[model samples]
Target: MQDITDVAKRLVQHNKGKITEVYFVACGGSLVDMYVSDYFIRSESTTITSGWYTANEFVHATPKRLGKNSVVIACSHGGNTPETVEAARIAKAAGAQTVGLTYNDKADLLAVSDYSFLYEWGDETRVHNNPMAIMLELTVGMVNELEGYDHYNTFMEGMKLIDTIVASAEKQVEPRAKAFADAYKDEEMFYVMASGASYGHAYGFSICSLMEMQWLDATAVHTGEFFHGPLEITDENTPFILAMGLGRTRELDERVLKFLKRYAKKIEVVDAKELGLDMIDDSVSEYFNPVLFYSVLSKYRYALSKVHNHDLDVRRYMGKVEY
Candidate 1:
């Protein structure tokens, strides 16, 4: 993780002001790409064009939507999945400079990219996506000229703050994740509520999308559309996770918190202000919580996977695929 961030700083130094804005084309694992793009938005002037596609349709559907003056940022944990690699190929043929971020050194994803960031973990670390997302956050920070912290030393210090919060989170993670998972586990459907930068939380919602691929149990809803009515009807078996959000409208977040406590069956908060990091307050300002979110979120999912008898590395089955 340290080396990935350091290399990213160099990439940012190298690419500083070279382009007008970055276009982050995210695909592959949902939370990983979502947080990476969130970090990019903080680091640079960026626009995200989703790179996801139905594997069969991507070949004909991509290309015209991508091209010069853009960078295709692809995330593939395995590094060599057929659809992701082929999507990277389409991204390149359209004249965009491609960069592959992944855990392996050599794979078809790297083959199609002009540049790559390799994290060296062949599978998601500890069967959660934190290691990969951390690398992506550092990559975005590095490429954005490292705006907030002038020295990498300061960034390391900030990470230490995150580590401290993570320790406390370890004590509470299981209970919180299980509370939501147990409620959600039996549901045929549900919604995830997120808005603003926290809207990136929807990436986790994609567990339902890929669950068909990996066959996990997940259902979710967005926060805004949810509160319009259903907020009053939830029970223990159906719950909502509040990415209560941050920034100028913090008063609104307070309201949401109150409403969740009153109307919803349960509420779980990934409080940016509580992460025991220098960035905690800043997580609210910059939505920098994604990096913090990844570490803690990874643990939550790990606990739930155990209770459900699902593979920890749900994206990879029994270590069968190697890149």
Candidate 2:
């Protein structure tokens, strides 16, 4: 695997003073991973503008600003997601610096992208090599080189602990996850909510894990948008999974949690604060909490799969029939 930071530094050196905007494009779970990077860049970079787009939409309605001075980071875990590959191709055609992240070195995304980084998946010891971590490394590295990020060193320090952090979180949350699966095994629908960077966790878990994998209906609700309309759906019998992160937007999640605690009976709160998030520096901890949250959620997802006798890989419509 190529060193993501070195690739990012090289990109910064090549594009020096010209890079102004970045677009993260992908679909489904990959898109959710990009959302975390998009959020990180927006929060940390002062000079760079960022956008997150679904791969197909990006290919069709390409941004006018996506040109030589822009960077587009596209991800597809298997490296063959058609829309993502096309998005990378389109971005390159628009003269944008394209970087592709995937677990496959032979992935088509690598062919279209200027730089390709192979990330590790399903490896407990190499958790830092995951897509989200790779993307964050690229973002942090680029930002540090382009415009001196204050917490660059701290972020690097935090990355060193990622594997341990993730492993500890998985162990800590295992019992809770089993209990959750057993309790919600027969539930037909669920609402997953979170704020800040952790929102991606909720979105991915709700859609990919619960809905697609388990054949259950699930909706992801942003805690910040809860009271606007989603709150009305809350009732004593409604099942909800709330992810609370140690980020700036945690209060937003807490506010929603308070309401859920009162009105909702079946609610599971996955708080990163309790999941070894504090092991990292506070400045960069929020960005890393999503990884911890995902680790915890994966255990729950697996447990649920067992309880429902539904294998996570078994899908009804996806890849079974042509769309």
Candidate 3:
């Protein structure tokens, strides 16, 4: 990961004035992993804009801004995702500096990238800390360098504290996660909602975990958009999983929570403020809550799979054949 920071710095330094924005491209979990980075870059810098796309769509629509002066970031778990690897190739062909973040150093995506970051770890490390953290670190560090924000240095100094926070969060969330899975393991449908910083978590968990992993029907809606249409689908028995972030948008989630309490019997709220993340400084907690939300809700997924006796890795179509 140290190499990743250097790669990020060099990417920024080399593209300095030429680059006006960065495009993060991937698919599924990888795409979701970049949401926080996209949000961070947009929120933290005025000089640059951040955009994201699934690699397939990125290849088909090819943004005009993705050119010689742009930076393209592609992420994949194994780094061999065909669409992502091809997207990296296209970006490079366009004279954009490409960075690939993956778990495997030898991934095909790396071969096309100008720079790549690989986190080599044993099995336990996979669950201990997600690749999402690495993506966050790399993106945040790069933006910090570009904007001259010293938060990067502070974050480096706090890695140990961050690890402690993750461990503690796991312990704090496991029981609740099990309870949630045990209760909802048989439920055929669910509605997940959130806004602000944690909206990505709600969206990703609903898509990647509930719909994709468990093959369940789930809907993810931004709290602000809930009343727009989704509200009509709720009733006394509807189940909801609300991801409440500890940011300015808390009020948005709170409004939905208030409404749900009156209408839904099975409403599970995963509030970042209530989670045991006090060790993380308040100064950065708001910024870090998205990744923390991943750590907390991921446990729910583990429990969900367990109670249903379904292996999380089971897939009927993903890797079995060409799409």
Candidate 4:
């Protein structure tokens, strides 16, 4: 397997000044993973435009900005997501530079991309190994190269402390995960809330873990939009899981938290600030908060699985039938 770092360096070197926009294409967990990358590039770069899109949408309504100077990044965990593969093919045909990241080297998406990075992760048990961090580093590394951010190396150095951080986060979330699982293992429904960097965690956890893995009904609602419609559905008995991160957007999450406290009877807040990320440098903590926040909250999946007597790998329609 090629080191993703080497592929990242090559990608940065080849397209440093030529690329104008980044189009992230994928579906489901793959799409959610790229959200942080899209957010990071837009937050840091002055000239570069970045957007993440679901594969099917990207195919039907291709962005006008996508062209030879754009970079399209496509990823699929199984490497066989039909829409993602087609999206990569379309992007490549449009003369855009295409990069593929997936756990499977043989994935159809890789075949259509210009450069590919394959990393082996068995059964996807560890959230830290989800490739979101690697893709985030790659996108940020490009920003550092082009915009003189110069934080890429420092961020990479800080990432060396990730194991320590994840361990601490795990310890903190373990009790909460168990507590939530013990309380709501048999509950009929759940709604997750997050905003900004932590939003992907909420979306991914609600759909991937709760709905798909645990076979439960779950909805992911952005905190900023909670009051627009979702808030009305809240009641004393409604279960709300809030994944909060420390960043400029923390205030948005806090607003939702305040309302949930006032109305909802069961509000479980998994705060990234509560986790020991003091080991991480303040300069990069905000950018990496999603990784940290999700690393902790992913524990709840396991706890819920165990408490509910459902195996996390159990699925009904994912691989069982054609969609």
Best candidate (score: lDDT): 2
Q: Candidate 1, residues 1-323: lDDT per residue as tens digits? A: 23555545544455443433343444435333455454445543443333334433555566455666455566676787676677678867876666676677766788897777665352233312344445445444544453444334544445545555656655666577777566555544444555555555545644633263325444444555555775656765554555554454345556666777765665567665555434444433434455555556665566556656676545554346765
Give stretches of model 2 more than 4 Å off: 123-125
Worst 10 residues of 3 by lDDT: 120-129
lDDT of each: 0.54, 0.89, 0.80, 0.81
- Worst ten in a row by lDDT for model 4: 119-128
Score candidate 1 by lDDT: 0.54
Write one digit per residue (lDDT tens) for candidate 2, span 179-287.
9999988899999999999888889998898888899999999999999999999899899998899969999999999998888899999988888788898898999
TM-score of each: 0.69, 0.98, 0.93, 0.91
10 residues in a row with least lDDT, candidate 2: 119-128
Off by over 4 Å in 3: 120-123, 126-129, 150-159
Scored by TM-score, the top model is 2
Q: After superposing candidate 1, which stretches have Cα over 4 Å from the reference? A: 1-21, 26-32, 35-59, 63-65, 120-160, 175-190, 205-217, 229-237, 245-253, 277-285, 313-323
Clashing pairs for model 1 are: 191-220, 191-221, 192-220, 192-221, 193-222, 193-223, 194-223
